[model samples]
Target: MQVLIANHGAYLSGIATTLWLCLYSGVLTLVVGTVIAGFRVSPLTPLRAFGTAWVTVFRNCPLVVVLFFMAFALPVLGLNASYFVFGTVGLALYTSAFVCEAIRSGINSVPAGQAEAARSIGLGFTQTLGLVILPQAVRSIIPPLGSVLIAMIKNSAIAGAFGVGGDLYMTGTRLSSAQGEAVVPVLIGVALGYLVITIPAGLLLGYVERKVAIAR
Candidate 1:
């Protein structure tokens, strides 16, 4: 208890920084994912292929490798950025691939007839996608998007390994090494911190899903 209290500031600061990174990355991922998903479902073969390849490459590559590349290779190529920025950007891109797939699945769940109806009303492809198909798809996507958000939150811990300071996992490691104690409490705190944020978001998404179902 004394150790925990003594390190409270470090712990809280770490948690706050990590949570901010996660939230920023998650929002960026969602936007990128939505656009990539749109490209994937586009009629143009080239666009579809490009989007597909992007998803495949990002999804299949190890995230640590991606982080390493962002930190080292990108700098070598003159794309220098801070470790925190690089880590967050890399995580966002990697997580966006998964998010794209989830959203694409939701888009697929929408009936073909909806698009057809929109077309019959003389709606252009962009308008139809925006007003009709996407709205319906969003109803089915809430739960999966929530899951992706949770995954992003957990994965933000990897930022610590890349030397991004003030992340929860990094603080835990620092505490363990400095105190020379087993890391159980530090690990426990990290887990509970994650759960506190993620579990409520998950429940909220569930409630939103239920409401959407009732409305439909």
Candidate 2:
């Protein structure tokens, strides 16, 4: 109500910040995750081992610890950057583990005979994976990938608490605690801001899933 009206500009800025964080982190997550998935499925034992270690560590470790390390520890080592950069990297790396697992599951779901057939035609490993396997696997990957991305959107709120200000969570905090706005109304606005992003995402993913299912 009044709280939202008064802070409309702030809310819009917060929403934009959240979107930027999600965009940067989401792209990185997919890129890193795809690479890790390839490593996990590679013929090289060393690559597979490295990929396994990556997923095991990042997936098992608490995200707060990862963000803390990125935000705090890296600066001490002279890798200084803005909190936004650290938050984006931490979020991406943490979420990439889950993305890797989802992609790996999709890879596993692809029929073995397809890969064999590709190889029989003299396609190399990379060629088979890039041209044949991943294309087919993408159908299965999309649903889980969408779920992971949605979860990542929610998780971005935590980054605001860790000094990555200018996000919806920080906006609400500022309004409620600093500006003396009623907590409930401010929180309602914050929830709506989140829904603005996530609901559309969920619906779009649903549509894509249905379309892919039909094509399959």
Candidate 3:
């Protein structure tokens, strides 16, 4: 408690930055994942192929490897983004691949007849997806997507290794090294900080699932 309070500003700054990155990455992941899920469920062969390849490549590869490639390889290719930007982008892309699969499974669980009925009512493909399919898919996917969000938050700790500042892990590293302690307190502090975000998120998702089940 003493250590935490003494470094309150540092800890708070780190948590704030981590939360910002997590929120940004999670939102981007949801959007990208949704698009890929749509493609995977589409009838177009090329779209399916593209989505399949994306999920395969990202899901199969280690996220740290992806981050390394983004940080190192992208600069060599003349596209240099900041450490925070690159780390968040890589995390989003990698996580989105898994999110895409989860959402695709949810979409597949929806009945094809609903889409057909929407089309019979003169709705275009996009309109049918927007009005009839995606809402149900989203409702089914909320719990799983919440799990993905928690995973993404935990994974953001790796940003410290990539030279991104203001993450909880990075701040902990700085404090631990500066104080020359055994790192137990630092680890505990970081864990608690993570729980501060993840526990509430889990509870909220649980509540949503219960509400959805009751409605059904």
Candidate 4:
């Protein structure tokens, strides 16, 4: 398309930035979500409440508001960072609640018998999760985590609207504005760019899911 050929450079940069956003946000979400999921699954009442509060608050809040706070409000509290950092952190925080829930669901999907059996073997709660529940939870965890990563790619576009530079959605919007009547092409380019990441991720995770599926 003329729009793409004329602005391939912008598209390339946008695609790269989108990928970068997905990378850092996805990794941080997984790590923090695991901890929160652990908390949700913990035997301690306080820990469970803390995890519940975290997911309830963040999950209910709109992501753009969270990003705006991270970018604008954090400076007043002396927690300033670059736009990329703020954007990545906001995306991670917003997405992690869902990740925590997904992982918690996987943890729940693990049979009650496993925990009881672990207890019968005298294993403590933490040990039982690390040794028994989580490892087996891996089968269910993969599919949801893949979905999270895909969602992150789409959500990362929000960063550009907030003035995070080099974002694909921003690039497409800018090109659309410049090209006058080619808005459709610009948007299609963005969609294809997103699919570039999500499609492969879906395939890989599907393969992994098939490979690790437990006979149930």
Candidate of highest TM-score: 2
TM per candidate: 0.94, 0.97, 0.94, 0.92
Q: In candidate 2, what are the lDDT values of residues 49-159, reduced to their tens digit?
A: 999999999999999999999999999999999999999999999999999999999999999999999999999999999999999999999999999999999999988
lDDT of 1 at 194: 70
**Residue ranges of candidate 1 with Cα displaced over 4 Å:** 179-181
Tens-place lDDT per residue, model 4, 1-216, is 877788889888988988888889989999999999999999899999999999999999999999989999999999977899999999999999999998999999999999999999999999999899999898888888878877877889887678777878888878877657388888888888888878987898888788887544
lDDT of 3 by residue, 1-216 (tens): 777777778888888988998989999999999899888877789998999999999999999999999899999999988999998899999999989988987887789999999989999877887789888887788778888888998999986679788788888888899777558877788888888878887898899888887877
lDDT computed for candidate 4 = 0.88
Winning model by lDDT: 2
Q: Count the backbone clashes (under 3 Å) in each candidate.
A: 0, 0, 0, 0
TM-score of candidate 2 relative to the true fold: 0.97
Residue pairs in candidate 1 whose N, alpha carbon or C atoms collide under 3 angstroms: none
Encode model 1's per-residue lDDT on 31-83: one tens digit a residue: 99999999999988998999999999999999999999999999899998888
Candidate 1 lDDT for residue 36: 96
